[model samples]
Target: MKQSLTAMALCLTVWLSIPVAFAGPPHGGNPGRGGGGFFDSTNEYRDAVSLQDLQERRRQREERGFERLKQLKWQTGYTMPQHYRSDRYKVDYNYYQLPRPKHGQQWYKVNNDYLLIDDDNTIIQVH
Candidate 1:
């Protein structure tokens, strides 16, 4: 009886070891659903953004920001590192002893035209 049980167990193990092949290759290789069969045809679009493209995008963004800053400086006459009047102030010209926004509240540049203030004094708009 023990030998019969052992044989049955061995048979069960061997049956389990047989790989159950599906009707098609695993999901990643077929376009019918999940597999990468989609690559069978070539198209204009390609995978992965090149580093050059990323750098170009970043350059464009920086240029746009500089242009915006130039326009703002001309319109507001407030240049950085020179301590211009912040919107939180009532007077146009005042000493540095101004009530600045509290901690956690960053100075927000509004509409790229004016500065907007929130309850927390965080700048919400940047034009």
Candidate 2:
């Protein structure tokens, strides 16, 4: 019975020591592994500032675009911007209650308004 108790005690001691023997570095495992030891506050702050700066720049760009659109006065006989001539801006005349464009002309949407432009990029009509 004493020998059996000694063997059981030895087994328990070995089982407990196994974890310590295979333990990671004293400062904990690699930070990338999320072992939780060291943290760089500066990096975190820089990342946050970078994200905020990107958002601010995006907002400013959108504001500038809106301002530019507002400043434009789509008058007849004036040529429309080349960007508005792309197929991406094309709209259906029937859906928007607009008149059918003649041959060589297409209906395009610029912001909230619709414009009828000819192949020459001329602003035929604005609605």
- The best candidate in terms of lDDT: 2
How much does candidate 1 score in TM-score? 0.25
TM-score of each: 0.25, 0.49
RMSD of each: 15.1, 17.2
| Candidate 2 per-residue lDDT over residues 79-109, each given as its tens digit | 8876566779999999989999899999988
Off by over 4 Å in 1: 1-49, 73-95, 99-116, 120-127
Q: Candidate 1 residues 32-55, lDDT tens each?
A: 654455654332133334656888
Alpha-carbon lDDT, every model: 0.47, 0.84
**Measured by TM-score, how close is model 2 to the native structure?**
0.49
For model 1, which pairs clash? 27-35, 28-35, 28-36, 29-35, 30-35
